[model samples]
Target chain A: MVVRGLAAPPTPWSKSLAEPTIDETAYVHSFANLIGDVRVGPNVLISPGTSIRADEGSPFYIGKDTHIQEGVVIHGLDRGRVIGDDNREYSVWIGKQVSITHMVLVHGPAYIGDRTFIGFRSTVFNARVGEGCIVMMHALIQDVEIPPGKYVPSGAVITTQQQADRLPDVKEVDRQFANHVVGANEAMRPESR
Target chain B: MFFPPLQPVSTVQSCVSGDVSIDPSASIASGVLLQADPECRIVISAGVCIGMGSILHAHGGDIVLEAGAILGAGVLAIGQVTIGANACVGSITTLFNADVQPSEAIASGSVLGDRSRQIVLDGRPGV
Candidate 1:
């Protein structure tokens, strides 16, 4: 369900009752919830039980062809934001073709670059994930910046810059797998709506 | 071109379900979800403030928020939780089967409770 944000004070960060702006090509499942200053780009698929709430953190951006899988929770703190690729400030900036898998949490100020795949049950908080990175399931990425094309193994806790820097590069199999998942989800966009 | 005053196009109220008792003086923000199972109960005392997008789920036990407690935005409390009087739980904190002492303060993004119980894997085969 897509709804308008809070109308009264203790208002949101934007201080206005901003409704979500979803591109016509995007498919938001009925069970999914979106509220307040959220921008959904073209061909994005939001599955059931997922919530993208921009009430507290205003102005979130989901780039085109992104898939937010089931039970994923995307929210932001009220204080901070990150600069997007376009140089605009956003509470959460998700780049094109990103796949945030089932039950993942993407909390701002967070920036996920293009073609990155965040696996199931992982948490990305106050961090920047560069383009083409593959984060395996059950990983915790907080307060760090991961360089491009890095690979984070499952159950890894990457909190400091050193840990992020020491991460391995994305292998060919991982890239193919991530691409396959994105393609499969994108194909289901028609039926998802 | 003339634009009207900026107002909400639609209003989504907080959802409260099943065996929940909230005092009239308590404040609940929009998009807050309070769900109690049939055998469970949720009691919200006076002067309690539950922020937007906070989720309180009482699965097998009761959840009680004592008087003057404050739950910041996006907080998650699940299963047999009791927030004592005047306690403040910060934003994005997760409390699972935990209890907060009276007048205590929990920091933002804190994850409290049993770590072993945090992840519940599906029982289905090949999952």
Candidate 2:
């Protein structure tokens, strides 16, 4: 059985509609930290020294079989940005089998689709990444919509609408990262030993 | 340097080789790793808040974190780096060879990788 090392926030912070939930099959490393209002799916691997804080504006959701690598940071919005007549808060969604690599930063309200690979040291801020996308290392994804199967090169900055329109589809060879990262990360799990 | 009162919530697990000092009223969160080389030193000044999983390594050079600097979660720093007073470093930022100016914000910054550097596009770096 996996130990639940995740902690609930203090009183005033807890008063928000934030709740923390994790599936029993997930693997969260002992050194990793998860703050309030985050939901983790099954077979997820939260690697060592990673922090996912949803204390601010959240109801963050991690899709099944996703892998959050070492030294990554994920935060909720400073305030809820989406306002409907009903005043409901929408969660930031990370889809199934996604690979959020080492040193990555993901800030909501962001939606990353299934089988996507967010490379090392990349930043995704207030963006929507479609299914099967590859965001390479050192890339900045801000306020954009990366279409399905798109491949963003390393060190590329996608901020302008023109730049978002100019992004290319993933090369066939690079699709391997999206295909294998989930199983590759699962091998690093302690129970796999 | 003199030590300050450590909060009960802070977790300090560091491996030191040389001189390392931290001021009082500093909050070093859980899972932080501080390493000081035999020759160099690491110093964290007052009112600094180091988020969880930050690695401060002073192996090749000295590290000085001035007063009121904030290091967000999963930040990595090494070498002769000085985070000036009241500066804020966002999460996953690496100051492997950096000198952040005081009150500067290094927001979601990262060093470029070998693949990005190795591309010989038109005989110059980057396309």
Candidate 3:
């Protein structure tokens, strides 16, 4: 279901009442909710039980071919904003071909670059993850910027810049695994619609 | 002066199921989910505010939210949990079998209670 945001605000932020703009090629499942000031790019698959709400935040952008798995939650704080790859301010910016696995929370102000794979149940809050990164399950990434192609192991907590910097680069096997997952999900886009 | 009484207008746009009781003064944002299994209950007291995209699932036990409790966006409260009155749980926090004290403040991105089963064993060094 897709709907409009709040018409008025009781707080300093959340003043916008804009509706979502979804491309025709995107497949949003019936049980998924996409509300207010959100832009869904082409060929994106929003699975069931997912919530992409931009009511408090002004705008969100999901690039083409990204897949948001079941029970994933995407929301943003009204106070902060991130600069997208396009150089504009956004509440959350998810780049092309990203995979947000089941039950993960991608809270803004957050930026996830292209081809990044966030594993199941991970939380990305107030952080910037560069292109081709792989974040494993149950990991918490907060208030940090991860360089491109980095690998975050499972159950790890990366809160500071030093920790993110010291992380190892993505292995070839991990990259292949992420690509495989993306490919598999992309094949299901037609069936999901 | 003739004044009309204040009418309680609480809006809930979430998907709710099973034995759930929501007070008329409670505010539930869009995309919030409340699921209670058989023989379990989820109670949202008066003045409670559940933020957008938060999920509350009661499994094998009751989940209770005391009056004026606030759950920020993307919070996941699973299993048995009790949030005391005026407790504020920040965004993206996960609670499992937690009993928050009254007026307690939980920080954002915090994971409280047991998550042993969810831990994944990665063979990578320096993790």
| Tens digit per residue, CA lDDT, model 1, A28-88 | 9998988889999998889888988898886899999889998999999988999999999
Q: Clash totals for all models, in order? A: 0, 1, 0
Please give, for residues A54-93, the per-residue lDDT of candidate 2 as tens digits. 7775777787889997667787687544321234454467
What's the fnat for candidate 3, on a 0 to 1 scale? 0.01
lDDT of 3: 0.76
Q: DockQ scores for all the models shown?
A: 0.04, 0.06, 0.04
Docking class of 3: incorrect
Output the better candidate (1/2) by DockQ: 2
Candidate 3 structure quality by residue, lDDT tens digits, A1-193: 2222332224344345677898999888776767789999998888656768797865899999889975687888887999999999999999998999757788899999998999657889999999999986568899999999988865688888988888878888767655543442343355532
Name the lDDT value of residue A3 in candidate 3.
Answer: 21
The global Cα lDDT (0 to 1) of model 1 is: 0.88
Candidate numbers sorted by TM-score from highest down: 2, 3, 1
Q: Please list the residue runs of candidate 1 whose C-alpha ends up more than 4 Å from where it truly belongs after superposition.
A: A1-15, A179-187, A191-193, B1-127
For residues B18-88, write the lDDT of model 1, one tens digit per residue.
99998777888778889999899999998899877889999889999999999987888999999999999
lDDT of 2 at A162: 67
In terms of DockQ, which candidate is strongest? 2
Select the stronger candidate by lDDT from 1 and 2: 1
